[model samples]
Target: MPSSIFINQLYRPPSSSSPETLPSPNTGVRAFHQSLPGYKPSPLVSVPAIAARQGIRWCLVKDETERLGLPAFKILGASWATYRALGERLGLRENGDVVSLQRLAEAAKAEGVVLFAATDGNHGRAVARMAGYLGVGARIYVPSLLDEEAISKIRGEGAEVVVYDGDYDQTVLATKVAAENHAEGKGVLISDTALTVDDETANWIVEGYQTMFDEMEEQVLEITGTRTITHVVTPVGVGSLTQAVVTHFQRTPRSPKPMVIAVEPKSAACLKASLEAGEMTSVKTEYTICTGMCCGTLSAIGWPMLKSGISAAVAVEDSDVDTATKNLQSCGINAGPCGAASLAALESLSSGEELALGPQSVVVLLCTEGRRGYEMRSNSQPEP
Candidate 1:
């Protein structure tokens, strides 16, 4: 790491080789991406044996914690979305970081093309990264309340910034409105949430997440020599990545289904509540330690898939997020609050008791980010 670098949270996911069998015709789109914006991070990470000793069985952490040098699982969704969107407009792919609007402009085959989005953090960074690689210019709108440190990082990526004087949700709404206005008044708008749900781009973005699962699958085999994954714990906001996990496992030809547990900050557990209600629903939405999970509305595409497919949905409090982070730290892993939401949920599921797993069971926690949440820590000490 550079001596000048500081710490914080960001989002992303990764890789499995193409299956020998063909991709199902109606399943999520499979893309062979190289040097793309998102990552194909290593999935089979070694955590301390505490989880295994607890009889948690084949517990594994699919660590995207180190992805793109950011600490969250959002990059896969955002970067894939950006790549395809650019392909749609420029016929050229963006294979760079979010901070290069100038680079994107240089790659533009069509005249006067740009990209736009509203995000809490990682999503904006990803959009900016893609725009940097593919467009003439890119702009991002964020909530007035986002951490400035995060904003600085995004700006460093060469994006023009619009700060909405409201919460993150407000930033999302305002950005969408701005993009709509820009499209109507000028020429076009590129929406991120559509990638969070259904649309060819979103679907492809979700498929990119399959790589994350692919790596985990290999890790599980290497660690336990068992292909059986009994449970998978994940964090959700609008449920894009959550759906990605579920969709991947569902399409996978295993006999028994892995329990898909969707964890979120209680205040922003839109998908959890929607699954309970058996339909897509919205909540008031609020701030939480897990900023990445603070979504008020459900992604229409994700809601139905999760409601039908998920084994359980859990809403965790901020304290649990802190605890999950501490636990990951003890294991020498750095994960953001959103990244550790899965471990937090699993901790609650076990009632804080040592897990009791039989030989046949293997539990996996997707540690979705690394050091990115250091910004939210009480002390912004340099990472260990």
Candidate 2:
């Protein structure tokens, strides 16, 4: 494999001042989600062989392949954000009061409200799924590079899919503009990324992702007899999921904070570049095989938390991702490109001196998605 990993240590311990803190995820988010039908925790899987090979004590993959019937973990955030946004609009404030999809649909219809967003694939599909559940209209914008299978999936959920002849950032801008131009009370932009840190919907999106970490806390203890997560490796597109991981570990009262490693495609290393420049930055990117992670800009809503929370950020090539995906397959874990990027980062760090991996370290990789119709491998067979 060609060496294509660039690592940057963004945070160091014994800092002069404390990092900015966000509101902790309350029990209400968990209760609301658990109340929904078919709400089960995704598996926290251990790959002993891979851990042994990497000279680590344990390697856990948070298998989010089938979260809430969605192919990717994006649904966790999208659904939560959608519920909160719609709930506020409908004047439903009490946490104990269950807001059913029927109630949401009736309110949305009466108020002429529609959910809108721009996505590379998974997030848009998730928002569409939520809209479908609520029997509301959904308008999703996608870049020209999105695969046909993903587009079909979004449309299959009864969402109006609009393909933009621009890159992901441009598509996001267009969606934002459209939402602003929509008739009064007709459109609600439920974007995971925004230009402002105080974007309520975007903040809610990050909070929505807290459910995954809550599950991980319980499952990690049950499986490992300890709640300490030494290291976390996850892909960074807009950094929403990564921010959630950082917040969860930082806010947990007794648990030791994990070293967060953010992975991105070499073609779109926005977060890495931003950290290097010491400011929010944007990059021009081409089509990368890791399509889901092809983001050029860091999310304004997520950057502050990621900047202060992540230990390091890495940019890996597409070939590295392919190797990682296959390696994960050998361990019986199916991961899409973006999902496998976490494993690729782990492999890179294992051979380097930047992040230590020893018998005491417990590493958790986020397998954010599974292979849908867009299969990157020829056969689904595992290597011996």
Candidate 3:
């Protein structure tokens, strides 16, 4: 198998990261192995009782809260794409450190590099952290339901953060407006999902997810002693990380790839509607307990990956998220609404019995983020 496959192709492992093998027009696809060194893998914990009580024997938790000091899965995709996009523009290799992001920000400031994105919590934080570390000024648009603590963390990362009027989907539109209003040139929108391919940032973000699958593969081996994943679940807000998982795993040794499930809130099931409609579509996003799943529109880049028969999208209730949060904590793990959405979907799936939960099949859930989302979970109102 090749070290890395093309963006459209399936997953394959090339030899470990090598400077000579970095993807080039001449060399084809290259792994960004050394591009960002010191990446520690996320731990995959076993939820035996959670699985057993749910009528399944076991479930694996791909805990990503500890990624690069961030408490979410957003960094896996965002950081990978950021470095790759910068590397391409500057003629740098995967092994090359190239120009520091701080220096590039100064130069980019002349040209005006302003990052933009709408998030419930994690995605915006990832963008803010990346832009701050790279020295580029960024304006992150977020919903009113966004946690103050998460926003403060993003602000600490040096991005000018804006709390928009409504939900995550509305914030996405507001962000587009902010990026277009960049008269001083500080508004280059760094969105993860869109139809146009001109911005290579999303693709790079997806690359960051590759390392995630790499970590997941290790966990699968250590826990199961075999790499065959039967079913996988991931929470979707923007779908960048979800798409990356599908893309990476689809290329692996599992020919009939695991049943990839998309977990979203029923109140704002953009990806769910898109899947049912068989196109990139949007749903009427209402204020819900699961603020993260309140994304109104589907990310165009991520939709194609989903529509390719790689996923089974499902809308989960708020109670499941609440229960999952408490469940994770009970198991000594911290996961917020967005992070627990995957497990929530699993519960729904378990009840649905569509995928048939049993001991023979190994289920993997992407515990995407930490309790930084605790502030925004709308427990005051009724469940979704």
Candidate 4:
């Protein structure tokens, strides 16, 4: 499929009296993250080369390559949601101490409580890692098309990896059913995506991503001595992370709220399709190198926010992602195909005036993952 970009006609700023609002800089979530081992803010880097090539003042990347010892930002959402979902059952308190967490792990193990989740890659590994921290077990479900390296990483975290013979959305349903049917050991679903907007666990997962933006805002201020971010480019899998971007930039009282551009694989551009249809729509996704963004459907909870808040949606072909990966790697930023999709989207949008990016514009690309191995679906060689 050819690459395309859609300007959201429904895009509008948040009204001062709007009831739909997500809180900014959630301190409690940040504090919880700070208490975890290997906790530190991911770097917000300015790539001058990219900015010059793209004709922007600065092209900043919020590098999530090494967040909490994981290769992606999925850990931020998975860990936070797991804590909120199973905290009481495992006797965990806010900012729970390491010793108390260890003791509660033993209690949780005796009680047979387990964490259940489905992912293309990063989220499942994160859930398994969280399960290890709490001395419980985890069962991670993945689509049959996922790469072996991703599956191996999840299994290495001591979780049982189940292969579902379907796409990502179907795998999520299978995982939900398995979690619901595991009558012996208590299973708690810690999914980040949902079929309905009211899924509490999914909402909590969205809340868990607050720390990333909080850190980005502080870092941007420290580096630029200003808070005038004109654009935030984010990759959309199920739209949960895009929802977080809109919540952080739109809800702020800051004037001229940053325009959010959501990027997705051309074959799996579900959010872009939904935005053009003026209603939530699902598409049949084809194979793409950006496996992480290969979701076929949009999260219901994120539709309203994304449709109204996102300035534009860009869907890029695998070749575009390959070029982006090479560009980022040349700069010593080990961004995978999915993570580099934001750069590709920016390139697509910059070709026209839809974005209105200027010399003073400081664009932040949310690079959600580091480089990983994957088979090339196109005729071109796989990203190195």
Candidate 5:
């Protein structure tokens, strides 16, 4: 069969300015998260073997496997967005006195507002975890097609789980309708991807992800003694995390903005299709092993940032993900299909002259998740 991979360059403006030059909500989001209990920066690890194989001087992986006691990095965004939205509902200012999750929970309970969201796996679990921490109720909508392992994990967080019979995009719509018809007026929809709906909370979700970049920036400088990040390869699911990475590097003062390449499952390469069409577009998607990146639509809140900041987009096949995951394991890193997809992109780019990675290039791959009952096997040889 022909390779199911696709690549496209985005149209960037001539005089584009970084969002960091302006005041951002991420500053407050970062501070809020830092104050939480058990909050610590995730590790930025250097994989010498992978670097050597790719012919790059440095290959750093920001391991988010253990973030906020979750197997994925979704909590960073879920926690911040939940806190900010809850604070707003309680009439708290942006810079209001720092409050505990318990206090926030009490206020939420009194107001009878329950946190709500639709997630593939990690994001819902993250939201449910936050709801448990804050002592509030959460109603999570998940696709019926989700693996039992992930569904069980979300339920373990004390959230009322509703599995809709459809795909992720359909589940998102169902969750939105449930929130709209919530008679108690307590459901707060915190979706990661936005369609034709109110996207304020979606924007907060994107803002919340900025904490990852903040931590990565500090960690990179601490480890390398130089803030030189030449390239960033991350999985694109509705473009939220990708937007966060792009905006952070673009906006941060005096920081070298790394070229961002987004990786997606070929079956669900919505962002790649969007870029090629020069507009927000959706694609007909089939199930892929990379469940977290199986989004068929782009987030309205994230599209603009990605359009302006991303250097390129690449879509790969399941075999590529399997190879990438096994290779990462050989390097002593545990990554799920979605997390390891970035390395697969790197492998593709390194093989040809597309990316031109060299000895001086320092690349960062965002390993967005840890293995969660997913089998990791090396079924194919690495591409040259």
Candidate 6:
């Protein structure tokens, strides 16, 4: 019920038996991304102050605060998945040179395609932005609990925003049904998470996320002159990004694959619950400032790999995230609650020796978003 860590007992060393359909270390997804306009690698920052405090050899932060003109890394997956999905429908070459957003817009407009998606915030906005690039219509669905600022951003992209009267999981189902029932038969659901394992678009979304990890590895090598990242702490929503993290590290030729650590809001610790149950499990979530991570279910496509791939799972309280956000800000890292959750997880580990991280351990915290507005937990609680 409080901030806690679960060291996975079923964890195994990286194996070769992972699903072949998912992204691999050798994929051309990054190449595809490189062809997009305004494509640049996000910064990998050294937080020496935190490193010294935590007694770790290095504490690195992959700053995805601003990626591709978006405030979060969700655009990485959204853009790539959008391109791939459109390319398939339009008979465009996969991994072919993307001439420009305008050219893609022309082609997609000629094809009568419309994008449909559900989001807590960032992912839906990314999807809508991509639809705008393609000159296509988009309808974004959101849970009733999403903040108005996020909903407005989605609408700003010229996408019709539909507020679902339920939680994120229900919103996803509503989007799927809406896409399927599109009267014009032109709706394409570009979802990052899926209820089924073999959803092609969902798989592409997972593949799209490899660009972030690829860039992180290159930056880590540049800093250490070797692939020395021993632990990767990631904030988990539906686990798509974390799945990308596990796949990249597991398949990397680096001598030892980095230990994968997943962090989520304590109220929405579905992955941790599933890991403990030795089967996929869902949780009833409550309000958390880490709104992007307030998902109640583990992504079905990611569950198999995450079952054995992750070394540890952490669930942090909103108060912990508030403190982490302030720490990151003091370090000049403008991170939102979701972005700061990785730091919160690290600090949770530092309070005890559960992970046994020592001076030799080199850790990378994936900060996935920039600063955003949210009520602080301390202020949100009613006075006794």
Which TM-score value belongs to model 6?
A: 0.93
**Candidate 6: tens digits of C-alpha lDDT, residues 1-384:** 433889998888675544465454536678877866688999999999999999998999999899888899998889888887777767666356444556667888987888999999999999998887778999999998888888998899899999999989999999999998986778889998989988888888888888888788789889988888888999999999998888887766775667899999887899999999899999977778888888999889999999999999999889999999999999989999999999999998853455658998899999998999887655356422
lDDT of 5: 0.81
Q: Which residue window of length 10 is worst by lDDT in model 3?
A: 2-11
lDDT of 6 at 137: 93
lDDT of 5 at 178: 94
Candidate 1 is scored at a TM of 0.79
Give the local distance difference test score of model 2. 0.82
The runs of at least 3 residues in candidate 3 whose Cα sits more than 4 Å from the true structure, single-residue gaps closed, are 1-38, 87-112, 184-186, 195-199, 351-353, 373-384
Query: Across residues 1-384, which tens digit of lDDT does each residue of candidate 3 receive?
Result: 211101112222222213242322211112443334345677899989888877765689998767777887677667656655655654554355545544555565456567787777677788788786666777888877666787888788887888887766667777888887887644666677664645466676666677777778888988988887877888776677777766666555564467677787777777766666667777776666566566787666676556653446777667778888888889878887777888877776544445546767688989887875453345346433
| Cα lDDT of model 5 by residue, 46-71, tens digit | 99999998899899999987888898
Model 1 residue-pair collision total: 32
Q: Which ranges in model 4 have alpha carbons more than 4 Å from their true place?
A: 1-3, 15-25, 88-100, 351-353, 379-384
Looking at model 4, residue 206 earns an lDDT score of: 88
Worst 10 residues of 1 by lDDT: 4-13
**Candidate 6 segments whose C-alpha is farther than 4 A from its true place:** 1-3, 15-23, 94-103, 351-354, 377-384
Give the alpha carbon lDDT tens digit for every residue of 200-245 in model 1. 6556556566667766767777777667787788877777788788
Reference-based TM-score of each model:
0.79, 0.92, 0.81, 0.93, 0.91, 0.93
- What is the total number of backbone clashes in candidate 3? 11
Model 4: weakest 10-residue lDDT segment is 375-384
- Clash number by candidate, in order: 32, 0, 11, 0, 1, 0
In model 1, which runs have C-alpha deviations exceeding 4 angstroms? Answer: 1-32, 37-40, 52-54, 91-110, 183-192, 195-198, 351-359, 373-384
Q: Give the C-alpha miss distance for residue 7 in model 2, angstroms.
A: 4.9
